[model samples]
Target: MGERPEGPGQGGAEDGTAWSGRAGAQAFAAVDAATDRLLGYPFVFRELSRRIGAGEVLVDYGCGPGKVADEAARRLGARVLGVDTSPEMLALARGSATAVAEYHLVENGRASGLADGCADAVMCNHVLASLPAEEAVLEVFTEIRRLLRPDAPFVLLSTDPACSGTEYASLRIGDPGEVYGPGDELTVRLRRTDGSWQEARNHAWPVGVLPALLERAGFRDVVQHRPTVEEALTVADAGFATGRAWSAERARPPLVITTALATPAPLT
Candidate 1:
């Protein structure tokens, strides 16, 4: 992928930098509520939850607020570690996650302070777009590769080309930000609760091109999820239709990506 959109703590959202102090709080409340409903899809957790061994330590990569981590902890019986960049988001995540998860706030999404080969699994849900540079996403990928056991899995779900501008329009939610190539990054500007705009550049990738990236990241048994907007809508309420229209566009269905077993390949 090209460069990612800006990340949580970087760019215009610098420390001591406030987007919409009260605005972020309110919006995240709604975001967390919506995420609760969205996690119900079978494609969300069935395989990872069912397949991994009991008591495995899984990293909920880019765990914005640990919603998916909470789900994984609830069903898989696996211990979860939720990671993200926004302290406010992390604090909220700490509150929402079950006691089963070990919560943490990373200074950057590209780095999780865990030791090498420690994690059994890593999941990045809509996290790619959280950072503006492809380097950031790639760095996060490299970190996941480093921390997970050689044979572990790293599941990544990112924006499908058709739906990238639209689904992300939530932060902007409706605005079609600039589109660059896979290797490019998009810095998005959106309104916080207070009616002001903040920018975070996250990386977007076409659903079709994830495999090559995964391969380079040292992941195997890589899988891709190309759910149609109609299917995604069935899983969500009418309220999310606008939130997810990018998936509905034909010729480029925004996919829900899933990768497995981060088993390391031999060095060439």
Candidate 2:
């Protein structure tokens, strides 16, 4: 995921900047909704809801249009705080507000204004890869740790660096004209429902590198999840049945879902 631009209606990066790009925002907003229905939202949300539980405070870092936050609030009975850098995106999120979810704007590269230890669980969905630098990603992780109580969960979802743009089950890379090398920043074009195209920029980080970064950010017991065909079939909605078949033959997973525990404080 890349940062959104500061100007109005321009899609830029997700590094705590406003996504003012109308087309980008609109495309992503649609993607956010489709993700809930077509992708693995039911499974992911179920896992998150179980881990975070009802009555827990969940901080959705880079919440975009607040789709996940709203869903968590409605389905799992959790209180969700959605933080994003894009005012345009936040505007959309606020427009669809539910009683259990709130939206806030955050500064680029910082999670300031949020109180320490205010969250029981932190989830960064497709947001970490948007960070241009490793330091920025680390800062976000550190901030997540700051916002969480000891041993709280930090869940992350990102594009699998191991899988090529053409290899994913549901996602298709279109008109990019080039393959991304390791750790390269690349622009991805996604086809929209109306036969239009939307673009997003992402950094390619290998799966092996993420756990070390989490550990350095003071998280422990890192675990990775690669949903299998059986798992996908069980949790996927009818609309995503074809995607499960596509995933069955793939050698690498399409998405990387990782979880880590915030390390406990040492007793004085």
Candidate 3:
């Protein structure tokens, strides 16, 4: 954690004490509203949902009011759990979600509330970068391994480090850039639904080094897939530039959503 937080902080456009009170609930609801549309949301919920392999349980790590979890449950027919540190965000998630958790995780971004060998898929969309530089990412990976039923797929969506720092900082909140580096203790300034801005320090990590981490975490069948901004829009019923709502909004963002799978290694 000594070095600069890698890359810029990015998120799904949510951040702050969102799970704490009325304000948090409103904040989360706004994020949902943006993604609720066919054009303006972040992440690929439908594609991610369709790809899950007969999942009994799914974990939406850094769930941010649980929109992704709700989408996963609705599409995958899997029992899903959404985890986030904000109470307001949790309430919003609970209202929209049909998952099993009656509560939310208020711990640091790297930790989660679910148990070991529990879920079949873990959707970490726009999540890992919110951790303290590097410490929390590994813990989260370990958590995924422990909660997964072996060879569980970790579907990750994060900002491409190839994207410029200034560009990364431009997203509103819940976007990784806004949540930058967990322990760099870098403060993030975010705008709320009420038209106010708040700041919190976060973590940032690039998309490039993840393969090595997956191998170290005992996940086999680890592979990388880079889908373009155009590809995501076409798949989510959103516009890519001018035609779909999703594509029109996210045409050129550095955001990258990749699907990676890991299986428990066979006994020697």
Candidate 4:
């Protein structure tokens, strides 16, 4: 769900950061829907839903077409707010608005319009890795921290830093002669629903770096979760297994799902 496909046009903030443009946004919306369906509809969101109770406010950071936001509102009965950088994507999200779900534009991860401590929980799915710089990622984390109440949960789903030479149903990484080390840059090729390919750039930070980053952003009790092959096979739709051979051949897990608690503020 975090993957983006480049198209004819690209747009961004005044700083010239590149987000999906009109054409790219349309393609990305389709890709996101297909990817979610193939992966059984935002498994990470479902997992996060299990942890929070009804009526809690959930913020979907970088919510791309509102798929996860819609699901969160429908299934968990939570009031959901989605924030994204792309106006085109935000339009798509708003087009399918639910009574409990709303979206706003966030330029460079600055949600100035949203009041402080407004979210009970925050979910950022694959957004950090899409950023072009580490500073941007940090800024987004700080923004998420700003939005959450003290001790609220911040759930993140992203590509596994330790993964190398892995192939999923719709993704491929670590080609021959490719190197991915700590802080190195890597490219992921994703298959779109239309049987086309889209490339997304990512940074290869070690698995240890994420928790430290979260701590610096005032998040505590960070816990990392990796999916087992059995879990993946089980959670996937029934059609995941077919005439093709079942192979769990991968150097490491393809995705990293982590939960961190926001550190409570000190009393004045």
Highest TM-score against the true fold, candidate: 4
Model 3 residue 117 CA deviation in Å? 1.1
> In candidate 1, what are the lDDT values of residues 149-256, reduced to their tens digit?
888777665554444455332343213755556645454444444545555444555556667666676667777665555654655455764464352243344446
- C-alpha local distance difference test of each model: 0.55, 0.62, 0.51, 0.64
Give lDDT tens digits, candidate 4, residues 1-268: 2333221122222222344666656656655233323333346666667777788888888777676678778877888888877777778778865644677778655764788789989887767555545676677788889898998888887665455556665656546456566547666666667776666555565556789888878889999876654564566555653323435322344666778988896122
Q: Judge candidate 4 at residue 82 and give its lDDT.
A: 84
lDDT of 3: 0.51
lDDT of 1: 0.55
Model 2, TM vs. native: 0.81
lDDT of 2: 0.62
List, residue by residue over 1-268, the lDDT tens digit for candidate 2: 1212111123343332334555446556654223324334555575677687778898888777666678768877778888877777777778865643667677765555778788888877767556667787687788778888898888877665455545342244322345554446765444445655445555666667889998988899998876654565567665565543553224544566688889895122
Rank list by lDDT: 4, 2, 1, 3
Query: What is the Cα-based lDDT of residue 118 in candidate 1?
Result: 76
Off by over 4 Å in 1: 1-26, 32-41, 108-113, 164-179, 183-203, 229-253, 265-268
The residue-by-residue lDDT of candidate 3 on 120-208, one tens digit each, is 77776655545654556766666666667766677766644343333122233234444333333334344344655444344445566
Better of 2 and 3 by lDDT: 2
Location of the lowest summed lDDT over 10 successive residues in candidate 4: 5-14
Highest lDDT model number: 4
Better structure of 3 and 4 per TM-score: 4
**1 versus 3: better TM-score goes to:** 1
